[model samples]
Target chain A: MNAAVTATRGATALDIAAIRRDFPILHQSVNGKPLVYLDNAASSQRPKSVIEAVSRYYEHDHANVHRGVHTLSQRATDAYEGARETIRRFINARDTKEIVFTRGTTEAVNLVAQSFARPGFQPGDEILISALEHHANIVPWQLLREQVGAVLKVIPISEQGEVDFVEFEKLIGPRTRLLALAHVSNALGTIVPVEKFIKVAKQHGVPVLLDGAQAIPHTPVDVQALGCDFYCFSSHKMLGPTGMGVLYGRKELLEAMPPWQGGGDMILSVSFEKTTFNQLPWKFEAGTPHIAGAIGLAAAIDYLETIGMERIAAYEHELLEYATDRLSRVPGLRIVGTAANKAAVVSFTLEGIHPHDIGTILDTEGVAIRTGHHCAMPVMEFFNIPATARASMSFYNTREEIDRLAAALEHTRKVLG
Target chain B: MDLKDLYRDVIVDHNRHPRNFGKLEPADVHADGHNPLCGDRLTMYANLEGEHIKDVKFEGSGCAISVASASLLTEAVKGKSKSEVKELFDDVHALLTQHDAAVDPARLGKLAALSGVREFPARVKCASLCWHTLNAALDRAAEPVSTE
Candidate 1:
């Protein structure tokens, strides 16, 4: 994009240009063109503060956390646990003990599946999930189903991509042990109204697990206010490093559930005869955790805090509207997801052109978009489409980049039409 | 580097009007190819006359590069012996992956159009899926070939 186009800013609260400067990766060029990164839903780009925080940790305070009497170990332990507190405060969780850092959202869901559902669920019990769930949320339950005769039931969605709440009411029955749902659809950007579902699940004596991987970056999540038993989200999706995420479980439920994995960190005392597990949070985090990732995630939270989540949400919604309007004008373009309430994601398809080809061509023009089933095959099956080209925006993304994307898409249609 | 390199006139034309498309009922050899990443799936069917391919058809959906490559494969492999088809497959594989591979138009003919897929690394699987499905048919494999 030219300087003039890049300079054009939306009427918003946050200074878009300053926000873009914080993320160094956004300044580079790709394929000899200015990078228009629309792949935020996959993994958001980290700001300089986050990058520096991780580097600073390794430089000055590098040691195995929570163990030794060495100064560096104490420092590392303080920082690691402090980061956990940061995440707890970010999500408004009542206690840091509720926040168990996992490898990512997938592992968090797996922990709930193995430790919570696998042991507790009876034969012929149903684990209900929505059609909009990513493979992370859906597969863990399938594994539990295979292990414990737990029947997996899906709450179908409409063609418009919203979760079918009426069908969900029917699906929640006496044997329904849990209702796992995606707070925001990664592929379609449908902001599911999970509060209603959570209320219904509570009435039926069922617990709800909210997959916040796609929602954390775009919206404000309060586990207590949302009334969900478990809330899972990945750090990388919110401008942090990968290999780190948080599983916010209710303290009582977590106390009852057995540890998913046992390793050095998760054990209180181990002998040949018996081994006692560590306390809350540590009991679930086996082996060494991603200490640096946690620190970087804390820095990311600080950055988001300075900017404010509600303000970012408002700006991103504006960007989504601008993108939808622009992309709609492109010949043969069809926006796939159009829920009344959505995040800054536009999953679209150009007529007579496959999404793979669209992605390839867009790459040549320096536009990065996710093009596939997006690990949500069931959602694709519902839409009756092979795949969609998803342009997912962030707070730093501007209208100018979306214009470049639209233009590149026009070129794509010409080439592949 | 350029769009023309990937979507050449011949490739685009083939994508617009794929040859030997749709189901071939009572096919002596059949196999399905699924690229799970992009959801590009195609079932290749062949009626074999001894070691020779008497007829071949495909049915499914995929990207332009994949559909065009499959279309070109059907045209190039028709009435060819198993050994001959194997040779052509080796050449097309090279053309789609190895950028510096030598192409002899005398042997490759129109399949040379797929050489552009070499520039796009991610699309390489898209171009080669049909060939793998075809090989599965030739080998009489029971499982569908998946490009994970």
Candidate 2:
């Protein structure tokens, strides 16, 4: 468990050496260079503990949940349900009934759109979202808009990439049926002050859905504290397994809405005439869930809990600052998203070289980064760029990695020069 | 593999100064090429002189691989017939995608520089976008050919 050589240490840092060692994938080489994974925003590498948890579940406790009376089924059900409780506690949601296991953030948004918002939405009812939303947040609403004739409105962002709170105030009128926004812009790393937006939405009697796919990994998220009606996040973005996510809807809201999908576990009892649905969360969880994925997520949460989200957040803020400063020094480089508040993502463009070229050169250096629109084409459209090379960070990443990224950019300049 | 293998001097030169890098108006054959993965957009125009390419031009924006490939395609296909160009496309496609594909120096000419794309599997589409679009143009298809 070698601590990666970092140039500086944050005052409230987790021992990054110990953190990096927990994830075995970081020890590998790419193109003969140590792998510098800066694509956490896309997907994170799983730690050994989380990996083993999935293996352990499949090896010893593999069974269909909430059905079989066998010990394995009971064990699987307990572990899966226990994961829900753990997530409820993690986000400080009031009850486990409020947490619905979704396939991922996309599914969670679709669930809300189909189950929650679709039922109540009237023709020309406006669904308000910020300009900074990822495709996951934007496209689902667009689909609902197309389906129900709901008007989709965007809260504009500033040049610095902050949500225009004044514009948001004007946009939250009576016809605004729901407000969905990115908690943090995945493309730009702009941390929208969602709390302020939520407050305004509440006064307008509009429910808020925060796309927490990017936010949950880097920061502490308390659904109660945030006071958003629904907070959707993916597990893979938070070091859990892919295809696993949690939708934290308010309890009364969950109780009131009809389930999006109906199948085996979601039903109370079925007959030729009629079938009563299951209560609360299980009603939305239609089929046999990702049993092992839930257990792996719980293990991931345990690992994050051990590190503590606040400590991780604090350390990552420092990492962001260091990365920003280091990356800004590269000639002809312009940081695309320059919000005062950002996650550990640094999206940038070189003056002459296309981001694709930068990405290619960086790959040669084993510095993996996200290139192109990053599923936020509107954000790129707003910025007047075709694409950017985004180097998003995580708790396990180091200053040395940022240094490597900068050095690679310098090499990229030389190579493309 | 070396980055030099991917970004050879010839590739970089073509990228910097793409030949026939604009629209050919009132053309007999025209088609657009799009690689949606990287947002590479290319509009290709060809003036056909009884199936022999009289003139060819392109206008668009993309990465080095894409731009250079388009530039090289315009130069290589001018005097060649549509059938010859189609065969050239097959040869260039193989050269770009297959690591073990042999390059016939005389046939490929400067277009042989595209053989570097074989080292970058992700970039094979970028190098062949113009070829696909040109093939579509040859068939008189109006739809934009996409390298997805």
In candidate 2, which residue pairs clash?
A: A3-A17
Model 2 stretches with alpha carbons more than 4 Å out = A1-3, A7-11, B141-148
Model 1's interface RMSD: 0.8
* Docking category of candidate 1: high
Interface RMSD of predicted model 2: 0.9
Residue A58, model 1: lDDT of 99
Error of 2 at A292 (Å): 0.7
* Candidate 1 lDDT (Cα, 0 to 1): 0.91
lDDT of 1 by residue, A1-417 (tens): 234133434544777777888888988889999889999999999999999999999999999998899999999999999999999999999999999999899999999999999887888999999988899999999889899999999988887889999999998999999999999999999999999999999999999999999999988888989999999999999999999998999999999999988788999999999999999989998898999999999999999999999888988988899999999999999999889899899999899999999999999999999999999998888889989999999988888889899999989988877
TM-score, cand. 1 vs. native: 0.97
- Among all windows of ten consecutive residues in candidate 2 chain A, which has the lowest summed lDDT? A1-10
lDDT of 2 by residue, A23-84 (tens): 99999899999899999999998999999999999999999999999999999999999999
Tens digits of lDDT, candidate 2, B1-148: 7899888898898888999999888887888988776878899998877768899999998999999999999999998898899899889988987778876868899998888788888899889899999888888733455769
lDDT against the true structure, each candidate: 0.91, 0.90
